[model samples]
Target: MVTMTSPAETAPTPRLLALRDAVREIERHAADRGWDGEVTASVFALVRTTDALSATPDLAGELPETALAEAASDPEHLTSIEQDGLPEATTLEELLAQLAWPEQVDGAAVVVERLMVPPEAEQGLPQDPEEAMAALMAHPDRTDVRLAAGVLRTGESWCAVRSRSHDTDDEVAGSPEAVPGLVEALRATFR
Candidate 1:
């Protein structure tokens, strides 16, 4: 006998579920920092749970017991390590272009926040970068949004997005390609 399963029935593999959890955790940490912030762009390395624990034994004790238990039983689990002191870059694209990860890094993720206006409000914008940003920030309908995207070396990917207006755990939305460009860029780092 043969069997077939629908896409919804097998959409999330163990590894992909683990990837989603890791991405959400990163997004939550960003939220906890409060919205009184700059337009920041940050990158993190997603190492295997076991590898991360072994690499920082002292840090393991600080992790929640539930997390430690999950890490021990699930080979697909991942731990996020923030990458700091990145070289200065004028744009997020430029920053991502400079990244190249070691073979041991199982995946990568990034969180970027921006202030934006509706498409109709973008017309007749100032040509200068500083002036344009100021205009956007001052627009009556402007919104603040944060995007978190992650990709594994094996090709699985996930994305989560939260808007300042609806900034709650239940309000956050996610999809495999919520931020396609960012996901592609992170995947390139593993190439």
Candidate 2:
């Protein structure tokens, strides 16, 4: 599933490279903590700029995308949670844990990881990417089936696709910008 691009075309800028490193760091942390889940469900977001969003620290590291979206839907919820009180933010993870992202995604770094299942394979596909992967691996007919995913965040989603059964090693997938009508599609899925 790796996208074959010219070396010149695939060269990452310094910022993007740094972002990639951050994604790796976070992922390694996740793995160490046994946060084994679908890449998407385990999505993390951060502020692209160093500007602080709130009184909290400038960085919002390794947060669930669903939590980010839910908190954005209502500010009062965050206020109420704050009033209730939680752990003090002494580290970036704690900071992210304590804060609720408002209805603003501008300049936010999103890292998504999801399993891509084919229509034919949908019957067995599970909502959890890890489970889906395990099922896919066990299945006999594993061809042309891949997990289309967005692994890291660097303006565009950083792709890391791997084969379902044969090749366990992750391949360097292509860089694709946000897709048009994706929001609508997601909404429809929820409905």
Candidate 3:
């Protein structure tokens, strides 16, 4: 009788090798820049999430439901992105410039929002999250805030769909009252 091999024992396919190489490049870049532990952890989380989503496209639909709901209930997760010392703006800008894939965009945005926006919102505005979020929404450069908002909104939308199907309340409530001003700012990107 022929012996059967388990899938886990099989060598990584070519695609997996490429992905591993890509991740290694990212790690080397992060190491070169002396990224903080939190930043590294967040990057790994994003990589895993992306890999999972790619392997099972159907899971994409289900991910948002649970993730968004969790984020809504625990905004701290969004705020803690900076727990790993924020990389220098130039370093972050460089990294962003290097990211070419759509999946990378999604992952990068998640990390950026968690690291940059919350601290900005905290230091620049009121202590209360609602008030701070409002101020961020209204700020002249609300793109950062909006990006974060979009992530939050997207996550909440996903969470609602997957975990708590019965909950009708919008998971991402409390939009800043100055959203129109923010929208105007977004339109005038040249300014």
Candidate 4:
């Protein structure tokens, strides 16, 4: 008897490979920057049907103040994309549940979260996380707190670190992991 395996069983699809590669690069960067601690990464895919990734401005790109509300699918926050807000997340599951992805998705991104101070390490940690994050962002000393990565429909790839003080052009020793959780997350969605 002859047997044959499906495309997925035999080898990864193009989209899968793209996501894996993007995640790998991001993780490598994280590891190099020493940001790969016990932080739970909440991964999401902005999947699309085409080969190009959409650069369309969406609420997800907003800063935390507005981002938190928009991500929760609040209508009041739906006014515009110029607002910058970061979503509030205590748990990966909670973050995943609250995400407001576009109706059309074509790519995947991983969000690795880190606190300015560890829960146990916080001697005077701010009760509100937004305050802590804002404080970190406002410091005169700039640090790269890199966070996310993506493969767009344009076939363009990007890895992002959530540092207000740093630019994407700022080069660092990138040494992301061979595979990050984003791959599994995207696969779970499409498969």
lDDT of each: 0.85, 0.37, 0.31, 0.43
Residue 65, model 2: Cα distance from true site in angstroms: 25
* lDDT, candidate 4, at 5: 28
Q: Per model, how many backbone clashes are there? A: 0, 2, 8, 28
Model 4 lDDT at residue 174: 29
Top candidate (lDDT):
1
Clashes of 4: 28
List the pairs of residues colliding in candidate 1. Answer: none
> Model 4, residue 123: displacement in angstroms?
28
Who is ahead in TM-score, 1 or 3? 1
Error of 3 at 72 (Å): 18
- TM-scores, in order shown? 0.89, 0.37, 0.21, 0.35
Task: Give one digit per residue, the lDDT tens place, for model 4 in 68-174.
Answer: 44334431111111112436777654554455445455554565744343344434547898986676556545344555655444343344444433334343222
* Residue-level lDDT tens digits of model 1 in 1-191: 11122466665788888998999999998898878567478899998878877877987877788788999899888988899889789988889989999988999999988776889888998999899888888999988988899999999988888899999988888877778898998888877
lDDT of 2 by residue, 1-191 (tens): 34434577867554444344443344344434332244322333443332232545433453445434544553311111111233364442343344343433221222233344556865857989899788875656545322222222213333333333434335423333332222222222212
**Candidate 4, position 16, lDDT:** 44
The segments of candidate 4 whose C-alpha lies over 4 angstroms from its true place after superposition are 1-8, 36-84, 111-191
Worst 10 residues of 3 by lDDT: 156-165
Tell me each candidate's RMSD, in Å, in order: 4.7, 12.5, 18.5, 14.2
TM-score of 4: 0.35
Which of 1 and 2 is ahead in TM-score?
1
- Superposed by TM-score, candidate 3 places the C-alpha of residue 126 at a distance from the truth, in angstroms, of 28
Off by over 4 Å in 2: 1-5, 8-10, 33-40, 52-138, 142-155, 162-191
